[model samples]
Target: MVNLWTSSEHALSYLAIADAIPHRTEGEGVLLNQVPKTVRRILDLGTGNGRLLSLLKIDRPQAECIGLDFSPTMLAAAQEQFMGDDSVHVQVHDLDQPLPDLGQFDAVVSSFAIHHLAHERKRSLYAEIFACLAPGGVFCNLEHVASPTERLHQQFREAMGIGDRPDDPSNKLLDVETQLQWLRAIGFEDVDCYWKWLELALLIGRKPTV
Candidate 1:
């Protein structure tokens, strides 16, 4: 399966409409609430244009942040957005592979990313994220998850104003329950779906201190 995100055209197309994804801000709001103001450092995966990272920085200005994206277009845009900020770093990384040694973080975040990975890769990434977190750290993923039925899936697409158009082949959405289970299995304490609006949901978990 081709990951459209690597193509500049595909990446640009999505960014053009990224903010208008309807009810997206609500999910982001919930994600922000979970990341405490005390975080010292954070990592963002597939951080398209560094949108989510920028928001987090506003709440925790002292926290150093790193953002990763495979798409050159996205990486460039993220770098440009954070160019003047001494605390932000943007790097090129393919989420399908293992995460690099960016050092442990008090928080790891992602927005509308990760669903593009194979289900197995998603699980492995979750394990890797757990490994990369400091004790009692947080992971917040505001993602596009699978619907319980084809009808509901179609409804969500329609709600997004993409009625009947072919679905993005890059998306490999997993169900919320399954993802929450994976988090718990990976030893993420207090794992749960913190917020949801149709297919868009926030999955959050904490690394246990003990």
Candidate 2:
């Protein structure tokens, strides 16, 4: 259900199973390496449980980070995870809406989240991310993308241990190439799919320093 994320129990269950998703760390690590350690401000979109933001903060301790998500349960969990730490601020916002005015960020990141949006929204969000970045800033998305064929999709489902379950209705999976093209078209430089294994992928791009 689209509204399932609003449930604390559902959100916690996702967190419980989050770590068991195969090769996730590898994609996350690649994303980490792409973000500059000297980053001053960072924004995490659809920041479920603040896990990715927490990882970024480990390398950039002084960075001011914003974790934005619409889910009440996720927002609560993220806020609790960073409570009393002024450096990380968790905000409640829906990605289905345009990004709020949070000022510029040196890096904008997301993980397996954007695919929940429609393709048009995904493109619009990329443009918004580009506009929200400071010149030369980076965008890294560890994403769940569509497989080119049903057989590959089935294989991916098997690998993720979800062989029989029907596809999630919230998922509006797009292919890797189209997303890369969208990033470049939105004025992001150095756009590419950096790392991928089946449906899981690391899509990266950088804003030009113009």
Candidate 3:
């Protein structure tokens, strides 16, 4: 219930350790592989500091990218990340609310975000993501998911070297299976947990071309 993302300190702390998260790049690589190079547009939800969007632009240089986040600190950092680049735009938007009318996208992606939302909102957001995708488009979410048991969760904490530290109060972690089911019920095809490393997992789904 305590969303500290709005605080500058919380945002900075996350940015400082963002790259150090174990196996994160591997999940990111898997996400990149799911999206096609020919995608005309991309939407990055909760695009903190635009990290994922930057990676996406590596192979999708011509793609028009939009990164959305509500935190002022995050928005500034994202803006700085894409400065002098007209193709990438970072804007203010809260993931807890309905996504703005940004038209449709060929690829919708997120990383290490979305879990902060309440369970009901998470499901609704997945539905909204489904609505925003173009036919044949894909949704790739590299997320922090819940473990099946508390012991596994504790092991994950220890693996992350944070066993002694308190859990992030902001994380409302949900299991991957429920999310995959939501995607399938929302009419996505080929829905599955494409990649995973302990609590980290990549959930991928595609819209039908027809």
Candidate 4:
């Protein structure tokens, strides 16, 4: 319930160590690979600093991208990331609310975000995502998921060298299986966790072409 992302200090602290999270790029790579190179329009949810959007643009340079985040600090950073790119638009949006009418997208992506939402909001957001996608479109979320046991959770904290630090109160992680099932129930086809490393996982699903 407590999200510190709006605080500049919290946002900056996260950016300071954003790249140091182990195996993060590997999950990102898998996400990038899953999205088709021919997608013309993409939407990035909770797009902090536009890192994942930047990666997505690498291969799909012609794709028009919209990156959404609520934090001013993150919005500024994301704007800076795509300053001169007319094809990329970064805007403010809170994940707790229903999505605005942004039209359909060929692909919808998120990374290391969304877990901040409460569980109910998370499920609703997944349904919203389904509605926003074009037929045959893809939705990929590279997320921080919950561990099965307290022992495993502690091990994950130790693995990330965050055992000494307090757990992020903003995080509302759900297990990967539950999320995959939610996606499936929302009418997504081929829903699955495409890649994983401890608590880091990539959940992907595609709208049926018909």
lDDT of each: 0.94, 0.92, 0.94, 0.95
Q: In candidate 3, what are the lDDT values of residues 1-210, reduced to their tens digit?
A: 778999999999999888999999899888989999999999999999999999999999999999999999999999999999999988899899999999999999999889999999999999999999999999999999999999999999998989999999999999999999999999999999999999999999999998
Error of 3 at 152 (Å): 0.7
Give the lowest summed-lDDT range of ten residues in model 3.
25-34
Q: How does each model score on TM-score?
A: 0.98, 0.97, 0.99, 0.99
Instruction: At residue 85, give the lDDT of candidate 4.
Output: 100
Candidate 1 lDDT over residue span 95-135, tens digit each:
99899998999999999999999999999999999999999
Candidate 1 lDDT at 152 equals: 98
Candidate achieving higher TM-score, 2 or 4: 4
Candidate 1 whole-model C-alpha lDDT, 0 to 1? 0.94
Query: Model 4 misses residue 113 by how many Å?
Result: 0.9
Q: Runs in model 3 with CA error above 4 Å? A: none
Clashing pairs in 3: none
Candidate 1 regions off by >4 Å? none
